[model samples]
Target: MERIELVKSIEANAERILEDFTEILQYLRSEGSDRCDEVQNLLFATRRMVDLIDSALEIYHYLIRLKYLTADTQRSETAESRDRDKMLEEMFRELNSNLGV
Candidate 1:
């Protein structure tokens, strides 16, 4: 697929993951010890989903910065975009320090 199309797919996947994450978080909050095991499994699944979304957003943004995708040709972001970008930057910083690469 073309760069723009690929970016759109990534954005769509990110949005879907965000929605799922929100729902899972709500479930986690309401769950008590009676559901600890089940909640733990769902939380693990949610973490993986979140990681996938984070990775996709990072790649898509990197491509945009590298001129693979144009700035104006993209999906709209929620207010959380800035926070998410900042968090991803921090994560990369931590990883760089740990790997020393």
Candidate 2:
């Protein structure tokens, strides 16, 4: 209900999405690249989406930090950056499994 709590919830959800994205991307590169043009194109699109998301989140975090540091708000939470190269070792639902990995 509070502002901080809402941001925390969003951050938690984003973490899960990031994890899934990383797993799916890795699987595609490892075993799906040679499948066909469709898979390759899809993978490229997904990667671009993820990159954009990361950049946007980073900017969001920076703006938040700036506002709080400038005494604009009492609620200040640092958006801890996730490791870009991290991998999720959990099983992910097959993304168009028939197409490839």
Candidate 3:
């Protein structure tokens, strides 16, 4: 399969996973388990995953813009996405800091 096709597939899957996290959050809220701390940690991790996936999609688009991938793949090119990706990347350094792992 083509690289663009593969990237598009991945982007779609990432979006689905992100959407699932919303449902998970809602369910957890409804449950209001005693394990609130653990649930909060898991929610943070989920947010991080969503951010990472979003950044990945943006990076793939940047690759396309740089001609590393086909120019025809994505037509929009904005600095905002790159800035957002960089912010997400910066969050990685602090990701496990509070987790103590």
TM-score of each: 0.39, 0.36, 0.35
Clash count, predicted structure 2: 0
How far is 52's C-alpha from truth in model 1 (Å)? 4.4
Best by lDDT: 1
**lDDT of each residue in 5-97, candidate 3, tens digit only:** 666766775676666666556655564446886677577767766666775676566455546445544433545677788898778757867
- TM-score of model 2 relative to the true fold? 0.36
Ranking by TM-score: 1, 2, 3
Q: Which consecutive 10 residues in model 2 have the weakest lDDT in total? A: 77-86
Model 1: per-residue Cα lDDT over 1-101, one tens digit each: 56666667667767776776776666566655666777776777678677767867776665666463444343335336877999999999999999996
Using alpha carbons, what is the TM-score of model 1? 0.39
Better of 1 and 2 by TM-score: 1
In terms of lDDT, model 3 sits at 0.64
Relative to the true structure, candidate 2 has a C-alpha RMSD (angstroms) of 28.0
Candidate 1: stretches off by over 4 Å: 33-35, 38-42, 45-66, 69-101
Q: Sort by lDDT, best first.
A: 1, 3, 2
Runs in model 3 lying further than 4 Å from the true structure: 1-34, 68-101
